[model samples]
Target: MEETISIKDIFKTLKKRWKLIMLLTLIAALISGSISYFLLTPVYQSSTQILVNQKQSKNQLDSTQIQSNIDMINTYSVIIKSPAILEKVIDVLELSQSVDQLSQKITITSQENSQVFSLMVQDSNPLRAVEIANAVSGTFQKEIKDIMNVDNVSILAKAELKENPTPVKPNPLMNIAIAVVIGLMAGIGLAFLLEYMDNTIKDEKDIETILDLPLLGAIQKISKVHNKG
Candidate 1:
């Protein structure tokens, strides 16, 4: 005969083994929390925005010139992070770091079909990240003008100290919460699977049904087996 599990059976199993599930969940949460707190490195980020303005219009009413300027700004964004730009940034800051080191910390991105450019910098130090971001943006604006012979770049926004810049990496509470949920699900699944696969007789009813016989004597298992020598 085929056996089936119902919601009632699931509820019974959970009721019977809730303690085990809770314990596993707590353990997982604690492990996750500890790892996040001790083993994770914190990263801070800052961003500055620059606007791409049309330096001039050969014909002040030329839409084509405006489009060309926007396209050039996109290309300039890529060049902003190139070694040439980063080298200048490092030199001006007098930062005791290599060009490659500066490059690692800075990123330049632009929105599609938009005139805004974003300079983002990440570092272990929050204040230093903001400083690097601002310095890179300022350096790019000045250098790009000279290189492209255009004067349309303008600072839209500067990175500011976050009164409450919540650290963006290694969220211990969130990690622990997720770990706890996963552990509870895994424990419950394992418990139900073990219960379903268990075919050994556990009660007198099971023995009677298996043997198709009348009730017989019952005995309890002893802590230690006795030898019949």
Candidate 2:
């Protein structure tokens, strides 16, 4: 015979196992919050903007020149992360990290149809992130002339260490919220699984459903009450 479940059965199972579900959720939240707050290292980001513009003799800006500069941003992005620039930056900054390790922390982004691009760096220390960002931009600016025969790159804005910089990673509340959701889902799944696995008859409803038979008479327990004599 095929067996099926109803909404009522689902609610009944959840109601009976509410305590277990809550316990799982609470445990997950605590674990996630603890890891996020105490165990995970916080990463900080710093960014510096650089412009790819040459000093034009004529005051009027040429559209073709501007378009060419914008198109060069992609090539510049790769060159900034190359060993030619990163190795120089590492040597100048006295950093212990290799070119590949430093390159992993650096990122470049540019606006659409614009000559300006940003160099972003992330590190466990906010001051270090800022220092790396500025150093990378400076090294790239100095080396591009020799590498590409173009003296067009200039630092527009340098990354700075703030007095009260905030880390960009290890958001505790978000992690906890995600954990709570996962735990809730897990709890609900376990609840339904347990209900499915249990086959013991509990009451008249189970007897009638499983045996396909109507409940007959039942023996009632009689309690004796003694009156004051």
Candidate 3:
């Protein structure tokens, strides 16, 4: 005979080990919160936008020129992160980081079929992120004029400092929530595992299930009488 467990049995198991589950959950939450708040370093991001427009006379403006500008925007995005631009930024800012390190912190992205692109920078300091973003945009604009011989690049927007800028990573609330869920799942799994591994006959139900027979009766233990003999 095969035996099947019901939802009630699962509920009973969980209730029996509720204390252990709660304890694990609390422990996980504490560890996650600590790592999020103290161990992980927060990174701040700042971004600036630049507009790429061809310097053409009113009579020279046409669809071909606009399409060409849009196509060139892709190349411009690549050039903005190149060492040619980053080296100048480093020298101007007097930053100790190398070109490769600064390049990793810089990001250039443009919208599909758009003439404007944005440069974003990330750093541990919010002010430094803003400075890097603005400096990269300015340096790229000046260099693009010399490299491409096009004086059409213009600064659309400069990065501004915020009074209370928010860090982009190390979200404590989200981390804690995830940890709690994982901890609860682990605890539930362990409880079921231990229950499955246990093979003790504690009651009439166990006997009936194992022997595949109806429970006849149960005998109660009584104290043995002792006489001074």
Candidate 4:
């Protein structure tokens, strides 16, 4: 005959192993918190915005020119991260990192059909991140004028140092929360696995199920009687 488990059985199993589950959950949370706070290095990010427009004397912009500027944003994004621009930035800032290394720290993004693009830099030092972001934008603006002969690239916003900048990575609370969930799942799975592996009979019901026989009766345990003095 096929056997089916009830909700009571699940609750019983959980109740029996709740201590182990709680232990594992606490251990996981501690480990995650430790890693987030002590092991992982904090990374700070700063961003600079650049505006792309045609240097024209006209008071109004033509739709064609606007679309052309929008299309050029992609090319500009690539050029901003290129060695041609990044090399100049490194030279100006005298950064210890190479062009490739600096490029890895930089990110270029723009809104769809927008003329403004943002350059973000991430570093361990918030001030360094801000400096790198601003330097990249300034260098790109100067280099683009020489390379593409386009004087339209202008620094819309420069990165500035903040009094208390926040790190972008190693979020301890979120990490601990995720770890707790994983620990709970793992602990519950292990509990069920241990229960499944155990073969010894615990009660009359287990004996009846294993032997395929009806339980007639159960014996009561006897305790030692104390002699009166």
Candidate achieving higher lDDT, 2 or 3: 2
lDDT of 3 by residue, 1-229 (tens): 1234677788889998898889889999999999999999999999998998887877676788788888998889889989999999999999999999999998888889888888889999999999999999999999998898888799989999899999988789999999999999988988889889999999888999999999888998899999988
Clashing pairs in 4: none
lDDT, residue 166, candidate 1: 62
Residue-by-residue lDDT tens digits, candidate 4, 64-123: 988999999999988989999988888888889998999999998999989998899999
What's the TM-score of every candidate structure?
A: 0.77, 0.93, 0.89, 0.96
lDDT of each: 0.82, 0.92, 0.91, 0.90
TM-score of 1: 0.77
Please report the candidate that would top TM-score against the real structure: 4
Once superposed on the true structure, which residue ranges of model 4 sit more than 4 Å away at CA?
1-4
Encode model 2's per-residue lDDT on 1-229: one tens digit a residue.
1234676677889999998899899999999999999999999999999999977998999999999999999999999999999988888889999999999999899889999999999999999999899889988888999999999999989999999999889888999999999999999898889889999988788989999999986767799998998
Better of 2 and 3 by TM-score: 2
Q: Give the TM-score of candidate 4.
A: 0.96
Go through the candidates in order and give the C-alpha RMSD of each one to the true structure: 5.7, 2.6, 3.4, 1.6
Indicate the worst ten consecutive residues by lDDT in candidate 2.
1-10
* Candidate 2 residue-wise lDDT at 210: 99
- Compare candidates 1 and 4 on lDDT and give the better one: 4
Best by lDDT: 2
Q: How many residue pairs clash per model? A: 0, 0, 0, 0
Q: Give one digit per residue, the lDDT tens place, for model 1 in 94-120.
A: 788887787887777777777787888
